[model samples]
Target: MTPTIPGFDYQRVQVAEGIALTTAVGGSGSPIVLLHGFPQTHLMWRDVATDLAADHTVICPDLRGYGASDKPADPDGTAYAKRTMAADIVTLARALGHERFALAGHDRGALVAFRAGLDHPTSISHLACLDVLPTLDMWQVMRGTNAAVGFHLYLMAQPSGLPEQMIAAAPDAFFGHFLDIWTHDPDAIPADIRAAYLDACRHAVPSIVADYRASARIDVDHDQADKDADNQLDMPVTVLQQDWGAALGFDARALWSAWAPKLAHTTVTCGHFMAEEAPAQITAELRKLVDR
Candidate 1:
């Protein structure tokens, strides 16, 4: 049976130039877009989106180069940069007649939400990020022995061709490894969903590798440039992350507060895949963020 998030309707919309996002729409009232992280899809929010759709209009999209979205060739890292990916969401939302809406993202999607809030300050009403820190802070603290926690970052940060080639050689195993390792609750994601994720990653290895490679270099530069310009997110911001940075000798909340003045930061006892592992808790947190 084709998996479906209850109360949600899925569709593919042409959101930008050569970019048509696979989006799931449901509910009524104010619109909210939920972006999923790496090695996952809109499927990550299967439970949470259905619940949110009971009240607000919940829109979940597989970000460009992931899932059912368009996978155009990016000549340089700029194309996969968070700023570019965020713009794609902005375009998609506006095209759907939502001039202003709350935005929430988990993992990689959260990075894009951060960029969207900064780049399009007037467009985003509320912003929520799950299980991530600002790109600049993340890079600054990842060094020496502490880097082992994120060894995949180093691998994905390499030349795009190599990681893409290597991952493609065993796409199912390569992507499935992260899926299995990142979640605190293994049963949260069903086998079919897991297979779907692996299929998507396998098919889009080049773009996926480019997305991470950009994060290592160009993405950091983009984050720093925003900081230097004092272009902070102007809306209410909520950041929910695992205390990995704190364990690694960095104050995660303190750093987040610096970038988002009207911010509520909390550390949750969950693995990197917070959405999948703790859907109810993540959903409750999101409601608070949206209600705030």
Candidate 2:
């Protein structure tokens, strides 16, 4: 079944060589690129995109290894780095004729958005991150039994074949585990959306793992470089996260303030899948961010 989001026109473009990006472009005015997270495709933003597209041109793309985007083999971790992935968005935006645009990402996409804001500050007009902390803060906050909540981070962060093979053999279980556990309301995701994620992950296992592995090593250096440059998103930033990090020993808002000069940071009761679990609230928060 081809799932549809009302009011948005779906289009596929070859945004990168040997890799075509499946994007949904709709509405008018300034552009807002929406990036979806791990275990999901651009479809995760269906409802949110509709809301935003009424007045703003919303561009939602399946990040390189997810959704309908090309899952071309990137064996060396060269392209899957969020930095490179972030650049892809910039290229896609330029192709769409926007010199600068607002960006919002969820989960893995949040990390990518962070990279885009820091690395190409001039290209991203506004930044919004959903349901994730900065990578370094996430590393520091996980310790003891509290770390169990994010065991996949460590598992996927491990070196080489182990994590990849383990997940490949049981991709369904691996991806479904998150869908079942991460949501406070599983029904909020609906069956087709959940299946779409599992299907994408199963097919794009290597690329997905590469995305995580890059975070473990190269992404750290990327983040460190931004910190060293004292480069921050000059535009307004809105960070929405769950309160879980607090229980696990992290001040979510305070940490974000270090990277964003103008920030509206808050924690909600929603679980990891905030976009799906709390659509109304998430959409409202995004409206506030875009309007700001």
Candidate 3:
């Protein structure tokens, strides 16, 4: 059976000059665009999107490089930057007839959602970020041994060739490693969906690496510029994470406060894949953001 978001109609829509995103659209009401994280696609939002679909138009997209979307090879890595990915979401929402929408993202998606909120404040009514810090904060906080926790980030950030070559040799293992280790519940993502995630990541090795590379390179430049400019998220912003700040001995809320002046930050014990491990809680927080 094809692994897909049940009841959601899938479409590939052009979001930029050379970029088109594969999106799953369903339900109807206040629009909410859900962005999936690394090595995963919109499938990450299966539970949360379906539940939220009852009341809102939930649009889930496989960010440009991660799924059945355009993966333009960018030597400078700007093509896969969160700035570019965020623009894809803005164009997608407008194309779907939503001039403005509520936005939520998990992991890498949260990164894009972060950029979207920063870059397209007028287009996002409320923003919810799951299991991630702003790019600038993410790089700042990971120090010494703590940085070891994100070995993949450093690995993929290397200039071309190596990461792609090594990961491509064992794509399933690379992608499946996160899908397995990042969650409190291994079965939270069932077999078929897991297979789909693995397959997608396996086939899109270079593009996925490019996406990560940009985070360490161009994405940071954009984020640092935003910071220097003192740009804050203009809308209500809610951040949900596994309390990495507490574990890593940093003030997570205090850090988020700098980016989101109006912020509601929550720490969950649901592990890294919070949307899947604790969908009800994730959905509730998202609903609250939209209502707020």
Candidate 4:
């Protein structure tokens, strides 16, 4: 059986034509939607969601193409664009009876949440992004040898066939690499949960690549346009990130501040998978963000 967040009700909700997101919802009060990152699912938010469920209605959803969510083919390359994914989130929240709600996302999900805040300013009451830079800043900072750390990003950003085939050929090794290296605490992701994430990635290789590919191309264009237009996240924003900037030779907080004027940026000691590696810390930050 698949591992799941205890007490959370799982269901499929249509957010777009012919596309339904597999969502896990629990608790009851104000709503907050959590989006999972790459090579994982809504299950990544299991602990944090449960904790927040004590007071807030926590909605966790596998982003389109990642988990059991509908993975429509990207014939035009826009299918997995963050703008498109962000719209799906807006529609998903409205479908679940929330015209507006607090939003938080980690890693790839953070990219989506960032786009959502820019595109649907009024729909997101509070915004929190965990462990990711905006797409444009991300590309800008990753230079020369430092870019080697994100080799997977370049690989997936390649045109169509090659990246998909390469990843699909050995999905376990491809997905497992991140799972192994990105966590600070091994016990944070027990064997069962890791297996669940691997299994989900194994089945969704093409869609996952498409998502990364969009980031390299169309997503950058979208972010650039917003930057050019002086558009900013007009909401209370909290950012939790590892001190990647120091290692990568860029200021993470300063880069984030360029977009989020009302921003609270913190350098976390945990690894990239801070949600799992530091759930208590993640939960506390999220609660503070909502209150902000």
lDDT of 4 by residue, 1-292 (tens): 9999999999999999999999999999999999999778999999999999999999999999988899999999999999999999999999999999999999999999999999999999999999999999999999999999999999999999999899899899999999988888889999999999999999899899999999999999999999999999989999999988999999999999999999999988988999998999999999999887
| Each model's lDDT | 0.87, 0.85, 0.89, 0.94
In model 3, the runs with Cα more than 4 Å from the true position are: none
| Model 1 lDDT at residue 213 | 82
Q: Pick the candidate with the highest TM-score.
A: 4
Task: Judge candidate 3 at residue 46 and give its lDDT.
Answer: 95
Put down candidate 2 lDDT per residue, 1-292, tens digits, no spaces: 8576677787777767887788888889889999998778888888888888878999998899887888777667677888889888988888888999999999999999999998788999889999888887677778999998888888988877899899999999999998888889878888888888898888988889889888888888878888888877788999998887668787888889998989998787877888777778888888888788
Q: Candidate 3 lDDT, tens digit per residue, 1-292?
A: 5588999999989988877889999998999999888778899899999999999999998888887888888876688898888888999999999999999998889999999999998999999988888888888999988788899999999999999999999888888898878878887888988888888888899999998999899999999999899999989999997877876778989999998889999988877888888999999999999999
Ordered list by lDDT, greatest first: 4, 3, 1, 2
> What TM-score does candidate 4 get on C-alpha atoms?
0.99
Model 2 weakest lDDT span, ten residues long:
2-11
Candidate 1 structure quality by residue, lDDT tens digits, 139-194: 88888898897887889999757877788899888888888787788888888888
List TM-score per model, in order: 0.96, 0.96, 0.98, 0.99
Model 1 — TM-score against the truth?
Answer: 0.96
Candidate 4, superposed: residue stretches over 4 Å from native: none
Better-scoring candidate (lDDT), 2 or 3: 3
Ranking by TM-score: 4, 3, 1, 2
Residue pairs with backbone overlap in model 3:
none
lDDT of 2 at 6: 72
